[model samples]
Target: MPTTTRSESTQAALLEAARDVFAEKGYVNAKIADITGRAGRSIGSFYNYYDTKQQLLRALLERFPAQIVERARDGLSDDWAANIEAAVRAYFHTFRDYLPEMIGVFQLSMSDPDAAAWWRSQRAYGIASVLALIDAVEQDGDRIGLDHHVFASAIVSMLESYCWTWLAAGGDDVDAVFDEETAIHTLAAMWRRAMVGES
Candidate 1:
């Protein structure tokens, strides 16, 4: 049990280090040696843990979405639209919580095919949730709205755009820009416009 705990701890550290290096240098330019150096381990030691850099990179790309979903689940369990809004907010807030890691992920997504795939999956999940929200809004079947999928796509695009801007802002304190209140305001505004056709 103790050995497993130690392995888990070290794996987390290595994952963090890989994220940093991958972000700064990208997959093509990032070296296994650099990752190992950042993790304070030798090449052989890194091999002992991960089979390859691509696998590690895949793991790094996947870590945050799962975390965001978990946090959303914890914080959002009420109404569906409200939960979606809360989930979006929670994701951005969590992104800010790990800004440096996020920057790396963004950078990787730009140049690495694997990273791009991971990013696409992330966006797809958000878009799917927004579509679900649209369904809930139309549960009455009045068709009393614009095409929910269209609106959902637009909203998801808007959100990802904002997040990309935040990631690139390079401010000393990025998290301050995305507090709970900011999320509530932006998400609520968009959702209200979509569901009620006010905007």
Candidate 2:
């Protein structure tokens, strides 16, 4: 039915709009009416799809990484730096794409249970990717107990934080150049430091 198809489309739009809203506003204080407004849908129609903001947010949270994972896999290869670069590009692109709507997900996660769970899930996936890169880069009989994962996490953490700051800063193309230079130099340093033997 056309009505059913339209209903599905409206629900998809709201879910996407809610993802942006939650990412920007965070989960604790974001309102359903605000999400509905962003989706250009009636309040009642919004309810027809999701009973609450958290429900829609969870759906979005799930969908977001699924999309990213598909992208990550598409760009995946045995080459670690390429994979890493592709992954980072995918992440930032997603972040940039969702920048306007993610306000809710950002502002209110510290206290919300659903958000906490979703974040744990997201963080775990990130940690896995970091570990994969570490495994790729580390040679056998390398330094043991170096806490490479922690090291990798700290590196990616800085990258993610910097990305958010860059997006928030509203800067020019010069800022992008700075980011590119800094990331390449910093990551090269990380690789150098991570080396345990001539390889």
- Top candidate, metric TM-score: 1
Compared with the true structure, what per-residue lDDT tens digits does model 1 show for residues 54-156?
6676676566666777777886765665676677777677776666555665666778888778777877776777776667656845353577667777876
Candidate 2 lDDT tens digits, 38-131: 8999889987877776667666656555565677788888766566656766666666666643444554465677776766667666677667
Instruction: Please tell me which predicted candidate would have the highest lDDT against the true structure.
Output: 1
lDDT of 2 at 32: 85
Lowest summed lDDT over 10 consecutive residues: which window, candidate 2? 190-199
- The TM-score values for the models, in the order shown, are 0.72, 0.69
How does residue 169 of candidate 1 score in lDDT?
A: 62
Residue-level lDDT for 155 in candidate 1? 75
The runs of at least 3 residues in candidate 1 whose Cα sits more than 4 Å from the true structure, single-residue gaps closed, are 1-9, 19-30, 51-54, 77-81, 140-144, 171-180
In candidate 2, how many Å is residue 110 off? 3.1
- Cα shift from native, residue 159, model 2 (Å): 2.8
Query: For every model in order, what is the number of clashing pairs?
Result: 0, 19
